[model samples]
Target: MVAPASAPRDLDRYQAGLAQLRSHYEVRTAWTSGQERGYLAAPDSARTAALHEAIRDADIRAIICVRGGYGCLRLLPHLDWTLARTHPTLLVGYSDVTALHLAFYARAEWTGLSGPVVTEWGDIDAETTEPFRALAEGETPTLGSNALSPLCSGTATGPLLGGNLSVLTRLVGTPYAPDWEGALLVLEDVAEAPYRIDRMFAHLQHAGVLDAVSGVILGTFRPGEPPTDRPTLSLDTVISDYFEDRPYPVATGLPYGHLLPRCSLPIGVPAALNVEEDTSHLQVLQSIVAE
Candidate 1:
């Protein structure tokens, strides 16, 4: 497993999940960091090389990142994508891995998994793991936002794009920034306070990013709550402002992101969003695999 970010706090926790993943697949881990504690995977080093090689391996159909703390952003510039484009693979992970997802989308138009990583695989249930398995098995996987309640009611269709709100916002104006036009942006994150969420949303709105999207799918916003302080703006209020007077469909409670049993989602694929009649649904319109 590549340490594309902060090394796992406890090696054993990650090892347990690695065992679980191997149980399901012919896993070949790239221990690029030599089982080191805390990362020193500098650019163009073994750490970055391992992931690039995996993406380009003709026989390795998928690449699952082991953990996501904070680091993939630094590895983006150093990546070599020729082999990856020639030999496509499913790259999976969320949080800090958002950098890699959008980078791949912009550089190669390669759709990848914006889902749970290895260490996060503890207590994997059908509700969570099934979507990812169906995706890997190429069964025209579609994840439902059954947990989501409508925030703004409407129906829309566009390419599904976005992950970890903070990571995505960081890419704004960068070469790797995702094209927001006609995209159904799905966003989620963990630990950030509601105001910080508000700030990121504001950045997008001001940058004309929000206006460029057809709709928004709100995934599990970590704590899924507003601050306890009375003066604090509820996450609902902060988000609602972005959609106010706009017709974009907005909804929440998607079982993705930092939530348990997180469902897998494909980046840069066409998907339909329905948020009418008090219900919210997302139907991925195509298999993400390239023909």
Candidate 2:
């Protein structure tokens, strides 16, 4: 389901991209444009019913958003998660879609994928596309990197959860927010200042969100910059201080965010985080479903 804030004129490009991705997969149907423009803010009661019916009728195995904007939260309350629970499917998206993922995670315990969308589909490199394909086919994909902070030199296993940092932070006060306990919390963001990142971490610490998680996997904080006015803490400092003395392992520098060669991670799947001598590895234990 494509949930865009506003419809773009470049529908041709969008269709071509979808065609490219479909060339690699067996896509039977596609759903684009919700009931409203620029976010389906409180989709009408009828439209809500239509949404549920469409999903049910299509028996969608996977639902990917068109793009991320600011309106996903509006569709949350109107969604019939009870119905969704009965007929579970893979929900794939990122950025603003993080709001929806949090809602599904907390409300229905639904596992989703934090990966590419329509716009990013064909544009992604082959390396990035391979992991996504592996995930969609219910195959476990192991993610590893040689560059990392090496916070804890051991392995931890739990359900994988998390996405864009700013989007995840927006759920801190809401019921949809995830309880990070025993979860490998992966996080990434784009164009955020280092100080702002520090402040958000402070908020997480104050809320006790960081302590409950089994481990931390830092994704690419793309276009991150330090403050210009005064000396500021680095992303590493923020992470080190937050996870210090915590029981779970904390590692950074994974290629899973708004960067080239992004690794597509299946949220709500049992996964292992192995921090070895020279590399960190993330291995999915099962598909993100009951099957």
Candidate 3:
């Protein structure tokens, strides 16, 4: 484990998560940070060095972040893409880690998971971890959600890309921005007001990201506390204005992101998106880990 973003606020909970990992697999920590440092888990130089060490270590097959808060974007310029590409280490985490996922993907074509961080593992139940376990074991599991609701009707097959929406929108016009062409964009966010969400989606549209993606899978966008002081449109209303009549497939209520029992999705893997009148699901076409 490495803390590339924020350090765990509760060390005991972090230890519990480590115990859980040790129960299943041999676990190691390259470095850690304490809350004394303030917002960043560690200095950018130290975080980048530790990450590079993990990347070049042949024994480390995967590099999982301890938690996600902020600071990952600061490490982008210092990342060793040549080493990362050659080593092919899988990265795991979500939220602020989305910056790293997309940057590694854009730079080295690295395929990682937008799943639980170490701190989150302590609280995640079996069902929540099963999909991640299956993927780590090289099993391609079909993620079908009965709760999926289609906003637009169609089917699309493409490499699955994307994570936290706010994190992704920040990459626009940067060298680390993803190749949006023919991608199945998966998105989620937490604690943002509906207007902010609307602005980000508009930013995507303005950047031509919306036009390039083959499909869109909307995940949990848990709203922040509603404003009682003014009139505002509902979250559903704001979102529907953009996707309800898209040319490609679009669906919401994917069981991923911020919430528990979230499915672990592989970035840069071929996947199929099916959105029909009464059915919706995503099927992984192949294992993310090469044999």
Candidate 4:
């Protein structure tokens, strides 16, 4: 979990949750600078590399960021994707970690998750626990709620990919941006206005990011606002307008993003998308790690 450079008020809770999480699987914690001023500042490269090595050598089945903040992108250029590819594992995080998720998908063609972090442990609600447990236990064909918007009705199958929209947008021209072709693109964001969302989508469309995808899955847009005066456009409208007459399926609200009881989706694994009934289902076709 990306602890702000400052000590957290709930450090004990965080530690306790970490302990519980470790009961199910091996857990390790690493950080750039414990006493640093900002969470986004670049991590010490030597130390960061060492931590990556430790994780790689350990043959860890999963890697979860302790938290999300600004500096994860700083480690992107230095990351050895070769090691990650050889030692395939479930790399998981959200928020700022979105940058890393994009890097993994683009560089390694490996599936990762844009789900809860260490901090989310203490806040775990019943709604989230089942899916989280299922993911950890390698359950397949997970089905989720249909509360999200439905732009079109259809089913498409491809690898799952995406995370925080803002972070995804940040890597637009970079080598880390995902190859959207034949991929089920899922996205979510927090604290942005509808206009900002529209602009980001516009950017993706202009960059040819959206056109290549097999389908689109939109997660929660938390803390976002529609303009008060004008009847601002909804997310569904933006999606439909963007993918007008596109062949791919478009479905929203897969219970991901900054929401309780989120699905621990594998980013690079082939999965089926069924939107005809306004439901999205993901089935892990094979193990993400070598035995």
Best by TM-score: 3
Segments in model 1 whose C-alpha atoms lie over 4 Å from true places: 32-44, 223-230
Cα-based lDDT for every prediction: 0.79, 0.74, 0.89, 0.69
Cα deviation of 135 in candidate 2 (Å)?
Answer: 0.9
Runs of candidate 2 with Cα error greater than 4 angstroms are: 4-12, 26-51, 145-149, 223-227
Q: After aligning candidate 1 to the native by TM-score, how far in Å is the CA of 271 from where it should be? A: 0.5
Looking at model 4, report the run of 10 residues with the lowest lDDT sum: 1-10
- Candidates ranked by TM-score, best first? 3, 1, 2, 4
Model 3 regions lying over 4 Å from their true place: 33-36
Off by over 4 Å in 4: 1-10, 145-149, 226-232, 277-280
**How big is the positional error of residue 235 in model 4, measured in Å on the Cα after superposition?**
3.8
* Residue 166 displacement (Å), model 3: 1.0
lDDT of 3 by residue, 7-88 (tens): 8888889888988888888888966544325788888888998899899889998898999999899899999999888988
TM-score of each: 0.92, 0.87, 0.97, 0.86
Ranking of all predicted structures according to lDDT, beginning with the best and ending with the worst: 3, 1, 2, 4
What TM-score does candidate 3 get on C-alpha atoms?
0.97
List per-candidate RMSD values in Å.
2.3, 2.8, 1.2, 3.0
| Model 2, span 1-291: residue lDDT tens | 544232333667667668876877655433454445434422445435544664576456777766676666666778887887777777788888788787787887888888887767757778888888888888886776655566777779988888888878878877778777888888888888877887788887778788778888888886466657778877667667776556777778888787777788888878999875577778899887547
| Candidate 4 residue lDDT tens string, 46-116 | 43564376547655567776667666666777778888777666676777777777787788766666667
